[model samples]
Target: MKPSLQLKLSQHLALTPQLQQSIRLLQLSTVELEHELERYLLDNPLLERAEDYALAANAPTTGDGEIAPRSDAPAEPSESASPDEESWLGEEAAYLRQPGSFDEDDDDYHDVQAASISLREHLLSQLGLMTLSGRDQVLVGCLIDALDDDGYLTQALDELAESMPAELDIAAEELQIALIHLQHLDPTGIGARGLQECLALQLQALAPDATRNLALEIVHKHLELLGNHDFQKLKRLTGCDDEALRAAHLLICSLNPRPGAQYSTADIRYIMPDVVVRKLRGQWTVNINSDAFPRLKINSLYAQILARQRGSGLAGQLQEARWLIRNVQQRFDTILRVAQAIVDRQRQFLDHGDVAMRPLVLREIAETLGLHESTISRVTTQKYMATPRGIFELKYFFGSHVSTEAGGACSATAIRALIKQLISAEEPTKPLSDSQISEVLGQQGIVVARRTIAKYREALNIPPVNLRKSI
Candidate 1:
């Protein structure tokens, strides 16, 4: 080994924090981008959501010349960020520029609710209205804590009692009262022990008889058998005539098994398309959503301010300004790449319909786009594809395939689609049996199992044979 030091020049790929943040923001869905921006605005007093800077997309930026707003959707201007070069935090990044705000967009927060409060919150609010002693309030508090995300109390009283603080002194009777109060809340049937109990609470006001009793037994004891379509066990256990059992089953089916579902705090975020696809002169063309990316420019106003008074940390300030420029550019570039990849693979879906969708796996797109698999996954997860077939999650295009008669690959989704059509077109007086549907698919050389057909039907949220049968 040579001891003397020699001049050497080497280059290595290093992901600086600013670059990493750009990459992360690049792939976020529109809603995710909004949430992230909101969070950053909260944390950084300097950054804002571009409320007054109406110049967002409509404003002009220096790079790539002037981008006009598309007739279909206008672009947004970049967010407000500081050009002030603090000694340490130094220069901040400018947001992506856009053509302008769309003429069609009208803020509608006045009507609909954004993701509702958790079941516990709803219950606690209702609980407060009740006149309870201090000890009773403590017990109710413990019960509220026991509720799961789905709003069921999975833990046994023993476990829950031990988990609670000693001051609560939650006994079984006290717990029962709290449970009653929870059930009585706006979204009924919450705090139930299991699916059976949940449904029972919802149906409590119903008179107990052959029909109601059958439902209780079916939901409580034979729910497993019913799921498996073990008709033999159901016939023996319920001990009702087939017609009576059928009625009972229909009644049970109408109940919401997870009552807390209506009040779920989990955000059911609406999908916003990153790209818009339309058939232009019989050919499918993709348009990247220029709306989401506002026209961002390094606030020359702030830049002029900083340029005149170059302080001691001039190098650091310049680096930040440059870094912000690169980050904004990278964000647009990454979004473009992902949008192109989606348009490339999902053309068939746009041309004909979802039934014509090609088998598009995440890895396939990731490899094609020269992006990491996880990166592609993140880009696609919670992301949507807008087409002539309407909007669908990116995940919907990728499905397991089965061989077809013409020696072509067929998608499980296509098979399910076909099954749904067949079932839907069938006479209500004569529903197609699962086995019969399986036979039909086999004759067509699709070769799906009867069990598989059942699974698919269930996945489509269709009821089984007895439920499907009608008067």
Candidate 2:
């Protein structure tokens, strides 16, 4: 109960700024690492990216520590440079000689479109073409903004009217009218409040026919039954023949459920493989992608100045530049080592397919590399490998083990691939159920549970037996 001063000795690890930067860089994805590098490039004047780090590194240096000029009349272009008869060395060398001499027709100089237009912006563009009063345009604009990414206006008419400024003097009735106008937008179902209304709007757009009428009725009354694939019950309730119901179901299924999703402004992220695996002389070799790496160098001029004057701004930046270069190199080195280990262990997967993927975990790679599990996890998180099949995340090779009858462990990924194959080969009229699939695997010496099969099936996005059944 009494507070007293006590002497205690404790041992703990403290992370330095450089160590923190290393950890952060190790975990960053390709896009994030690019942004981080750009930030450092902007903040530190002592840091600069090397156009050809390999060439600079190999180029002979004079005794005074300066890069010596080439004495040869001319040197051959790099293998990476594309050949061009019009240029002296090559297309790459020509561009490098004149930085602004980029050809518009070149793939690297492609004029990519700006970010995708949002659903609201698309609706507003259509509205701009219409000659409407200012008040009407404002009402429609508000309605368009209220609609969600799926093109459904989730808010109620009353709520929308209440949120508007009092000076506008808008009413729920006006909002309801605006909602109807929004439903007539280019997307066909932009202002629908719910799934039922969305389908109904699409039905209205179809030509007047018995199929459309039946489909409209089905959507209005028994969407739940249609979703359940209770064709018999739907036929009974709708009092339509089998052929007619089938036609109506087909028509309904053709409608877009999420019209606005196509116009989503969300940026499309591209994968940059950290390591590339290629087969050479009947052996798989893993190599780090030079393009994925950012070649960095310390500004020799600033570095020289900082050496004479220690404890200056330039000195701090110089140290940071060195740390950045070292950390980036270490990141790629770790990635290459991990990828090689994976390729070595799962060579069969590359040679054959996912069926040959062995059961592996992060611990295996961590222990093999003499690193911690957390470090391995960070390394593999966003790292990717390019192979003959396709690009795959480094983590894709690691999966939980499932025991086999032969006393061997199989990867869950391999099992999922097997299930996908079984479903694909199944008869349309009588699709294989989860239990049947499990039994099929059991016959192949792999004893998987029915639920596990079902889980794997769902993960592969394979439909249930009822939904997969043919008409």
Candidate 3:
């Protein structure tokens, strides 16, 4: 080690508190932004919602951007202001003017009735109608609880009986009877022990006919062959011709595999778009949703107090409030700019459909906006744009470039859309294979490999030709 220190000078990036806050705010989604603003309002008294700003004659209005010092004088009504011009906190003020006012249509506060009954509740209600001994009902309820969310009783009757309390005296045979009764409940397949049993339960609920009997046979023995789409094996095993097999296949397809899925407890997510795109005078326009961003402003009263008490620990709070406001404004401004650039590039997609989408990359928008590619990625993530067609994520506009024969690049999104269109119009008996799709695209002057087509087809959820083919 050298005893003497050598002079070294280097420059490296440093993220200041303000810069860090700005970067964090830039990455937040609409809901997250609102929560962050709420936190700022709670933490910093100098910051308030924009709707909370109320001006009076007695309160000094600084036109030079300097905060006024606090005075003993009380605020007086402005002569020029209307007699009924109320503050945002006023209860009787119009909601449009009072941004902090509670929304009557807000489902978060109001109790929304359950859309549908739970599987247990549905089964219990049906059980109430049936004349059963309380002991039997208890056994049925235990079996109902044992059934998984997919309406399949995964546990065996003996296993279920063993898991129960010894005082209940529920035998395996009695539990089996209870399960049979439970299976008869609405949704038709509630308590079946397996897939075959579930399908058989559903078949039994249907009217007795040749199609129903054929479906029963297919489900009972050839369910595996049917699942594998091995029509030839099903025909050999069931001794059914193509016509009968097709009818039975259609019947099986019509049945619900997971009968209890209708009662799933998962919450349905609601998306609120950040940007709205529309056409005016035949020119596409992008508008940032003001409602999605919280309305914030510096509290003039607190600002004045802080001005009087400068360098008394309030300066940092004031600076923080200012930084938050600036960062929030910059965040939305950057989002709007990025969204506008995207709309300009994806105008064809808006005009037509996904098929018209041009190849787009994050670099282009980042360069156009004079921002880093990572910044563009952050802007696109968790941000949605509402267009005339439907709402889409900002990232939906960006896709890998696929070159056409004419030396032009097409978006993978557009190619996928094209593949979907071709498959939708394909003959069921002779569905287009991935190679055939690539050939069709080549015919249209778009050069795409069979494997690429297959990848795109799988992404679109279009099954392979064998799986897609109907008898």
Candidate 4:
């Protein structure tokens, strides 16, 4: 066979570095974008933050065209300014001069965060003040260490004693004594073995009375019945009247099952919405949050040097810097476009709350904006919108739909909101069951299955009818 060489041309899609960067930045949240920019700023000398340049706007330039260090003193307003304008400018200057102002570089600016102390540290502090011998203190401290963040001693005393050194001669009874001392800490339920014991400990801490005794007995023995809202069984077993049972139930409800939770360090995440939705002139308007948008610009000094020297080593870096700045701006622009589209679609939700939310999906926004579904997904992934109702991730607006009897569709989110409203208005003694809720929706022409009602109810953290019942 003769070998023949022929050239064939075919086109395939490829992502350029700039396009890849734009996609990546579009998917990142506000905090993550800031972190990504910090990495870029550290690696690229031709990139600088716009905030720094603005802060040094009044400073003199050096021979190399770099801005000189700014002085600590505040700049004064011009004397030629009008009296009214001067007064306004003076007030603005005073605000900017205050501690913890918007200026991150201000020496006196410090974020005020509540000091958090862990459960173990709190228990140890209480132990330190107690009049106990060294050995007793060590044993109590060991027990305190074994407690979980919820203040429950999940480990068995026997297991704890066995895990200790044999030479130390620790026993389960000694650990029990230590447990007793540890339970006497400021938080009443600390060192409890289980929910029943935790509640019992809290109940026992209260002064002796008929209600307290009944509540303690209920916690120790009939807790499961109480949890199931089997009020009849509780009454028969505890031999208490409806009024007494209700009072005891109220007392039990006031006790915190997780006493140590107050001290536990919570991982609180803050969201910076990329866009803010507001009702202006009877129209829902979307505006980009200036703080959430990253302000990036190329280093003018390096750019100037590259422009004059034509074949400088920084030319590649200069181009990269320009690409990043443009890409970041494009990222926010795409986000704003997508967000505005979402706000436009969800205007009913903003006006009348979640129950009025219309069914939406990424495809609708993508088609409206002339973008791909994947692009819309990326734009909404971590991007948030601050609205009158609250801050919600853009993805929250898009949900699957349920068909109604009238040939219309209802959003699952709207259905959930309806279920929540119905349950909130239900009588405590006879809370609406899943089937009843489903029927209520059915009567409204929106057919939702009992299982779906249960699912949405659980998602909303509402208990079942059996558990929601009260005396």
Q: Which scores better on lDDT, 3 or 4? A: 4
Clashes of each: 20, 0, 0, 0
Model 1: per-residue Cα lDDT over 246-304, one tens digit each? 78778888888787766665554444555544443344455444555543334444455
Among all windows of 10 consecutive residues in model 4, the one with the lowest summed lDDT is 99-108
Which candidate do you rate higher for TM-score, 1 or 3?
Answer: 3
Off by over 4 Å in 1: 1-153, 158-191, 201-204, 208-210, 217-224, 260-264, 305-327, 330-334, 337-345, 360-384, 388-404, 407-416, 419-471
- The Cα local distance difference test for each model comes to 0.63, 0.79, 0.78, 0.81
Which of the numbered candidates is closest to the native, going by highest lDDT? 4
Task: Write candidate 4's Cα lDDT for 185-258 as tens digits.
Answer: 98998899999999999988899999999999999889989889999999998789999999999999999999
Instruction: Give me candidate 2's TM-score against the actual structure.
Output: 0.77
Q: Name the weakest run of 10 consecutive residues (lDDT summed) in model 3.
A: 87-96
Better of 2 and 4 by lDDT: 4
Where does candidate 4 stray beyond 4 Å?
A: 5-9, 52-116
Ranking by TM-score: 4, 3, 2, 1
